[model samples]
Target: MADRVTVIGWDGSPLTAAACGALGAATLVAGAAHHLALPEVPASAERIRLGSVDLAARRIAGHRGTAVVLADGDPGFFGVVRTLRGPEFGLEVEVVPAVSPVAAAFARAGMPWDDAHVVVAHPRTLRRAVNVCRAHTKVAVLTSPGAGPAELGLLMEGVHRTFVICEELGTDHEQVTVLTSDKAADHTWRDPNVVIVVGGPVGATEGGGWIAGRDPAAGPRGWTRPAQVYGGELGEGERDVLRAAQLARLGPRLGDLVWDIGCGSGAFATEAAAAGAAVIAVDLDPRSCARTEAAARRFGVQLQIVLGTAPHVLENLPEPDVVRIGGGGAAVVSAVADRRPQRIVTHAGTRDAAERVGRDLSEHGYHVECALLQSVDLDTRAWTETERSVAFLLSGELTRS
Candidate 1:
């Protein structure tokens, strides 16, 4: 018979009959110290404190009798159940779930969270969680010790966000504090907390969304759209064909930050935002910034618009994974290179500018490449044809650390 494992979730509630029975009869119990200390876990059961979950899973798999793994909240929702269910483990599990922390956090705040994007921030991907907060109106960040509210608050300096900080949920020490993102840094928040980053004001309630998260599918249907879609100056922004080529080179993806420098019509910025990347559109012209904001609103995506000159304006923004220099010359290219983005794509209106960018990027330890993207349209009725303007596309990747 397959090894029988019962996964029980404890949400600071009195144990159910099934959970109590499983724990009472467990031959081996694996759980956190807090869970193990619960009176329901029988004295006869051998306890394996959950340090590395892999180690705990191994102990449970090898045990001769019924094994119970205790977890917090719903074990299936971004919790321990997935690790135990892997094929390598060869175990059959029955899960008894209690409330998830995400649900409890929202309940404590007295708001509906059907629309909130829930992201967990570990040491490696903390910036990504912050980026989601920057781009979305509603987010619940499950934070680690080093990646908690203080770190999040620092990143959210200028943004309009209300933080509902819930610490030690479902415990006697549980506390929920409501503060603006700007003010969150002032207090040292306790660990084992969830921060609800609301885009507007604190305690604001939102109507139910059809789908969860800041929906990636909520925006324009396809990319490389016409300039009129963004309401930009006609024939000024990157045309559909050129935009397609640039997108291919830039490669914006989920949980990434993309900078659209000199976002003329907000075309590229909106497209990247729609593709699930947090986007910052920078332009010297106030009109361009306004247009980008309007385009983002029209498409139901978010773009952080900054009206300032390049290099100078790029300083305060969050680090970008990918950058597309739609405008600015060699100086801007060199400045961007200093940031050491994983990938950089620059479009030069002229061949001379392209050559300068390629050379500069190559010197900055990037594998630089250039492509000339040109297209032609034919007039069938008039029996006339004309070649479209040529765009010099320069793309680079970091070659070294």
Candidate 2:
């Protein structure tokens, strides 16, 4: 007498009596080959193997009688249930949830995951998943067959991160291996795995404690100050010039969201956020995120640092008013242009990268302006030596033509 179709979660375990009854009564049942081979599936039911998820959704949609869709782990968290039960099909699904792979992986690692950022790495969009691993301190990556531990480790080669790869969770072949980012890249791993990146320190497990909404203003602490004010081991005079030029090019205003791509020292983002704009700094290094956080605290500003590589990660963030691409190449410039920000600025160390930025912006309808500035350092001898560099500043405005 149940009116709604049921979507069941099977975690490689024997089906319960309640699940068996549902499966037996189902006129149509769809799941992966591994899931369909289970003994609990009724002999007479029409079985559709899940090759393409969209195709499986169609099979479930066409069924006239009681239909059942089986998925692995929690169907709600990055699973097929969301796709199957959407408005296009108008099929109401009763979900029987199971322990999510992310949860299981974290549990096996003996780590708390409530504060961890969760991402999925499928064949289609693994780069974004890599970016998530780069940007956040603690992350749980639900990996697909081709995008497992080795692949992830390879993509995150230079970044300093600790990888805890949990394979075949809840199954007999279950193995958990902890490795440094470099070590993980060197080894092959099993499919259906989860990759956990511990961001802060190796053993430190705690939330960043960042509250939602605007951060408290550093009272009497001016937001944008001269780079010399942030004197540190890394804050050299040459860096000061670079910081000043970057800030001048970015021109972040109050309430604007600035995307400081390839934020090296977090100087630009820190200065902008101090100037009253909300800043999200993107970098591939976890160490960079830590450094940026420290710099923000020192300068008394709210700057959110995302540990991920760009172009892919940028697609997932909110559109920004201003963008600064301090590194990466023409692809980075083109990606930011696609988002159609009010202004885009890029600093290039090489001539080839500079030309690409100029051409890419022009093609995207930007009133592109490119400039190459070389700053000369006057040392104790009072002899000036110019540094070699080039920058492209592209400004896009409303043009009727």
lDDT of 2 by residue, 167-225 (tens): 88867898999988878867878877888987533212243345322234423354345
Per lDDT, the best of the predicted structures is 1
> lDDT value for candidate 1?
0.84
User: What TM-score does model 2 achieve against the real structure?
Assistant: 0.63
Q: Which 10 consecutive residues of model 2 have the lowest summed lDDT?
A: 200-209
* Residues 250-322, model 1: lDDT tens digits: 8887778999998888888888877778888999999888888877777667678889999898998889999
State the TM-score for model 1. Answer: 0.91
Q: Which clashing pairs does model 1 show?
A: none
- Per-residue lDDT, model 2, residue 371, is 64
